[model samples]
Target: MSFNGNESSAISLAVATEMTSDYRTNNPNETKAHFFGKNKLMDILNQNGCVGIRAYYGIDADGNKQLVFVGADADEKDLYSGVILDMSAPCPSNCDNTSPLNG
Candidate 1:
């Protein structure tokens, strides 16, 4: 299917909890989530020809997991030379402990 830049990715709370729970059960000691401000997300989306955003799994120098964001065109090509956003606040260090997704 071709990407028209719009995708519905919302999941029910129960599904989200289960997915996060599964990850925690297996990893035990990993970041549960990352926080990116709306401004940063909008900046990526505002890039020329940016129809969507793509995230890549990464590892920082400290061996902690990280996510790198970049703009993706409707053709599903990453705009590597365009704006990139990273350095997000990670869970454990910056998490909402009460959230089911973090539990």
Candidate 2:
């Protein structure tokens, strides 16, 4: 689901209710997330300390083809944060990274 500027007021109220603060009051130019499709493969990777996924168009500082991230575990400190997004059409069935682990 998505909302435009027209629903800004309603979105503010809902965000305040759940997230405790709406971006309108503090920063009028606060960016909103564009999409929220569930990524099932995020589970297996997270057990290794990965943090999240951000699917925006742009480039890394090194100028690599940097879409579909798999990162977020910090340096030297071993933590299993988890993966957040895998932007494939469909991960293979044979892959052990299945759902229900975090469902």
Candidate 3:
């Protein structure tokens, strides 16, 4: 999908990847043992009016686990507010930290 400057979808994917990568690198064991399902990611996308979503796990240059979430909106002008959570801090059992639309 074509993303304008700082598109929400692109930004959310980037944030997810960065958070996962950091978590994996710092906690490799956790990455292999604990699997964060795509349900949360999909919820975020769906709540934001995304018609489609794609998620993946990978390692970053720093050997960190990366979780990427990509989504597409049919309406070009459609704007989404909140769709992601901040990974900078520890998330509760519910995985609720911060809003993805924030940054």
Query: Which model scores highest in TM-score?
Result: 1
| lDDT digits (tens) for residues 1-103 of candidate 2 | 3222132234554444445234324543332222224445445334554433334354446553224433334342323244434333322222233322211
Query: Positional deviation of 28 in candidate 2, in angstroms?
Result: 0.5
Tens digit of lDDT per residue, candidate 1, span 1-103?
Answer: 5568777688999999999999999999888899999999999999989988889999999998999999988788899998898889998789898898987
Candidate 3 pairs with clashing backbones: 20-65, 21-64, 21-65, 21-66, 84-100
Pairing residues by index, what is the TM-score of model 3?
0.31
After superposition, which runs of candidate 2 have C-alpha atoms over 4 Å from their true positions?
1-21, 34-36, 40-103
Order the candidates by lDDT, highest first.
1, 3, 2
Tell me the spans in candidate 1 whose CA falls farther than 4 Å from its real position. Answer: none
Q: Candidates ranked by TM-score, best first? A: 1, 3, 2
Per-residue lDDT of model 3, residues 20-100, tens digit only: 667657765543222345666556566655655444565557675556555546654333354543232223233433543
Supply the global lDDT for candidate 2: 0.36
Regions of model 3 farther than 4 Å from truth:
1-34, 56-62, 75-81, 85-103
Query: How accurate locally, in lDDT, is each candidate?
Result: 0.90, 0.36, 0.48
